[model samples]
Target chain A: MTRIAVDAMSGDHGAPVAVEAVMASLRAHPDLEIIVVGDADALNKEIARHRKADVGDRLTVQHAAEVVGMCESPARSLRQKKDSSMRVSINLVQQGSASACVSAGNTGALMATARFVLKTLAGIDRPAIVSPIPSRRGHTLMLDLGANAECTPEQLFQFAVMGAVLAEAVHSVDSPRVGLLNIGAEEMKGNVQIQQAGKLIGDSELNYIGFVEGDDIYIGDVDVVVCDGFVGNVALKTSEGLGKLIAQFLREEFSRNALTRTAALFAMPVLRAFRRRVDPRQYNGATFIGLQGTVIKSHGDADAVAFASAIDVARMEVEQQVPERIRTLLAHSLGE
Target chain B: MTRIAVDAMSGDHGAPVAVEAVMASLRAHPDLEIIVVGDADALNKEIARHRKADVGDRLTVQHAAEVVGMCESPARSLRQKKDSSMRVSINLVQQGSASACVSAGNTGALMATARFVLKTLAGIDRPAIVSPIPSRRGHTLMLDLGANAECTPEQLFQFAVMGAVLAEAVHSVDSPRVGLLNIGAEEMKGNVQIQQAGKLIGDSELNYIGFVEGDDIYIGDVDVVVCDGFVGNVALKTSEGLGKLIAQFLREEFSRNALTRTAALFAMPVLRAFRRRVDPRQYNGATFIGLQGTVIKSHGDADAVAFASAIDVARMEVEQQVPERIRTLLAHSLGE
Candidate 1:
């Protein structure tokens, strides 16, 4: 049986929606056990909506007195709100009561609590926030989504290695091809950090494909892309913005005239397929890798379906023993 | 009469296309005079292709011995390629032979030669690359596109001032709103540099709107978006890539079947309008602001139409006296 800890008090929607999603997911997977960490009264009220009698055997509630605000500093929250639900969920992973933890709370708080409670994996300096990027060919995993704002060349090289291992383990790709995100394809095109990372990647044993520009992110030319959190966050948000703008423009275009409305009926199938291909929910969760245990972050606005998909991703990561495989791989090449 | 220096040998298509575009632009505006800078031999051959014989009176070729390669380092080229067309173009502007210099060669080389030849205006440490970004709403001018890689908070503040003055001169907007590009909209959201820049922008005399995120670039909420060259380059390229990807996807979607093809035929007018609105050529030419003289960079792949548009933009910048206005604005703000 797989046990997962859900941070019931976190997210924009708070514990109600998170509890409902977990219950729905539980209905689909009968063997799974969920540990809800949050205020006892709120958890009981939400669980009662699903009828505690139906899920009482599969659901367990852990009480926490404090909550971490979305705007609170991560370090301050970690030091002050020791009994917060975010901290409690991470503690479950550290105590080995859960295989993984899932949260939609303050990203910085979760990262800090995870690092302090669960600890970083051996030989890992800073963990990366890795996400599955939907591409033209298929899906590609990218790292440093929002974990480290600044990174050294060695840190980026480590992210490439860790991201490659995660992609191979979760997606079952053999020797995942890695690419360094840069302004240009030339080895000498980027800043001092990218230049140094390029040299390190070229000298490493991983299957490092040469540099890739931002345009290549969706081109599906490579399996993994590595960069610092600052560039990665901007890139991720830019892509999201573009997707929204394009969708909005198409919708407006389709509604502009009677002929377009009639033509939209004929093109609904293709449009629907295109929409699914770029749907944010289809690629919902981002894995917080390089920690001692698995932690997945679902989008704050994610529905039941998206949260369930995140749970599925976490299960795969744990089942594959990705951390051990990465340890072995890095030991051989990185001399850990 | 407005005089412009054109680097006839620059751009991907070379001299003939550039000459053709310049001639076409001249025909549209009878008051404009153009000095075509290139090898005298190549200029005469391309010049003969134009059927209008009297165009010779409005245009003349200046001899230059060398052309800079697109990949050549800007600093090295400035030191070695003294007789290059780019250098000669800047020399013409400095010597008051022309109001502005427009080139389609290597961006770094053009900027470096312009700065070295014309020097920065008083109280300006580094020049910034400014471009007019086409948003959902009309348009907004963004600065530091690729001029300075690393910037201090003070330099960013200066960019805001220069950008506002240029927008006022060219777009005829009074007190254009300036925004700092950051990951979030909150006051305390960005890195140390952004935090300091935010304070400076608030304290400065310009209409400094607080922090703006990546998504805001397309929303057209603010008139001027400011950031370091590294972030600006990433944002610009990412947007360019998305534009191309959307165009390709639209083409594929339209060609999926005969029914959709007929629908595409009916939607052509609306689609074409959308394309025109987002077309990069419509906003060609980025001005290297803050130098003593104006230098604009057209795209490397600029065709006749795009090159002509760049020339028009150059004309607008020159006629509005953007450089002199920026100098006055900065000198007043800094009390220098």
Candidate 2:
């Protein structure tokens, strides 16, 4: 049984959403265990209000005094708020009481606290935030999603290895195809850093393809894409913005007049299928890779459904021993 | 009457598409004159096939013996192919025979030829590819779209002024809201370059917002977004790929079964509206800003209708004196 710790008070909806997600998750996975870290009083009320008589003792509550606000500085908040739920959740894993941790709070704070508590892997300089986005194939894992704004070429090479490990262990691909994100596909296109990173990745044992542009990320043919945090973050956010805009435009267009309204009835099924394909909740969890232990960060505005998905991701990460495999891959590839 | 030079031999479909676009554009704008540059034998044949009896002598043909392939190195191609259609179109603009030049050839070659033929404005160090993207507020103009891989804070500042000039002259916004694209919206979030750029923008006379993330580009609230060519190119290509992927998914979903297929009949209007809303053709022409003369770069795969759109863009750009306005704005803002 894998035990995962939850930051009960960190998400936009706070204890109620986390508590409901935990209940739903526990009822679904019989052998799964979870530690809910938050204010004991608030969490108990939520758990008591929701947990049924048939509920198991697999779900437990851990008390945390303070809460980290969504906008707080990662370093300042983690230092001042010693007993914040976000910190406590990472502490549970560091103490070996939980196999993995999930947080839907301030991303910067979570990364800072997780790195401070768990530290990076032996050979890894800094941990990368790897998130799965829906693509034409199944999903593509994009790394350095606002973790380190600037990275060295060697760091990008490390990201390729770490991303490959997760793709293999979690996604079960035989040999994942990794791509380096650049302005253009041509080898001579990007700056010195990307060219250097390309050489390092090519020399490695990983199945490194040449450079890929932004659109290649959604084509979904490749399994992993490596980029610096700055570019990765921009691409991710731009996609979200575009998706929202398209949805808004569709909504406005479908409601323009009576003829369109009638057409909307017939378009419902296909629209629903389209929704499922591009659903933001389905792509909620972002795995923080290169750390000693597993940490998954969910969208701050995630509802119970999305938070539950993040929990599922954490469970999968721990069950698959993704971090251990990454360590092994790094040792095998980089270490002489 | 404004005369525009067309690179007739450059696009995917070559002279046929260009000739058709010229006829269509002439029908749309009675006062526009075009000088089609390519092999005299091929262009005259195409013009004879499509040119109607009522067509005025406003249409003319120029002969060029050589052509630049799409993938050839920009410098090498420009250096070797002196009489190429791409080069001759810019030469017409340089010789003051045409007000603007439009090309659908290789982007690198186009930029190289345009830069070599028409040097940048006095205060500008490099020319930026400024293009309008469909957004909530009609459109948002993004600059440095693969023009310069790297940009200094000052160059970004100049892009702001140039983009603002286009927004005011071409987009017709009196006071355009300009934003600096960054990983995060926070004041201290981005790297040193962005931070310094933010400082310069905030201090400048232009209407500057603090910071905008990738998603904000599609939000349509801001008028102009400035970034280095590398990030801008990635964002632009990613949007294009996602747009295509979503369209493909919609096609597959709407035709999955008999029921969905039947619903497609009713949903046709809405889908068409969606298409019109996100039509890639409407956003084709990329204005080469900061140059001494006007130049428009159309997509290589542009169809007749899309090529006509590029023609319309050239007409608007030349009539509005976009380059002159950019030069004036630069001299006013930074020249002193």
Task: Report the number of the highest-lDDT candidate.
Answer: 2
Lowest summed lDDT across 10 adjacent residues in model 1 chain A is found at A182-191
lDDT of 1 by residue, A42-114 (tens): 9988888786666658889999998888888887898999999999999999999998989888788888889
| Candidate 1 overall lDDT versus native | 0.82
lDDT of 2 by residue, B245-302 (tens): 8888889999999999999989888889888888989888999999889999999999
Candidate 1 ranges beyond 4 A from true positions: A27-31, A39-57, A185-190, B51-56, B185-190
| Model 1 Cα lDDT, one tens digit per residue, B75-99 | 7888999898888888999999998
- Where model 2 places Cα greater than 4 Å from the true spot, the runs are A53-55, A185-190, B185-190
Chain A only: TM-score per candidate? 0.93, 0.97
Question: How high is the DockQ of candidate 1?
Answer: 0.38
Q: After superposition, how far is residue A279 of candidate 1 from its true place, in Å?
A: 0.8
Q: What C-alpha lDDT values do all the predictions have?
A: 0.82, 0.89
Estimate TM-scores for all models: 0.92, 0.98
**Per-residue C-alpha lDDT of model 2 across residues A1-336, encoded as one tens digit per residue:** 999999999978999888888888888888799999999999999988884554578988999999999999887877898899999999999999999999989888898899999999888998999989888888899998889888899999999999999899988988899999987622245489989999999998999987888999999878899999988998999998898888898888889999998999889879999998889898888999998899999899898889999999999889999988988888888746
Instruction: Give the clashing residue pairs of candidate 1, or none.
Output: none
Best by DockQ: 2
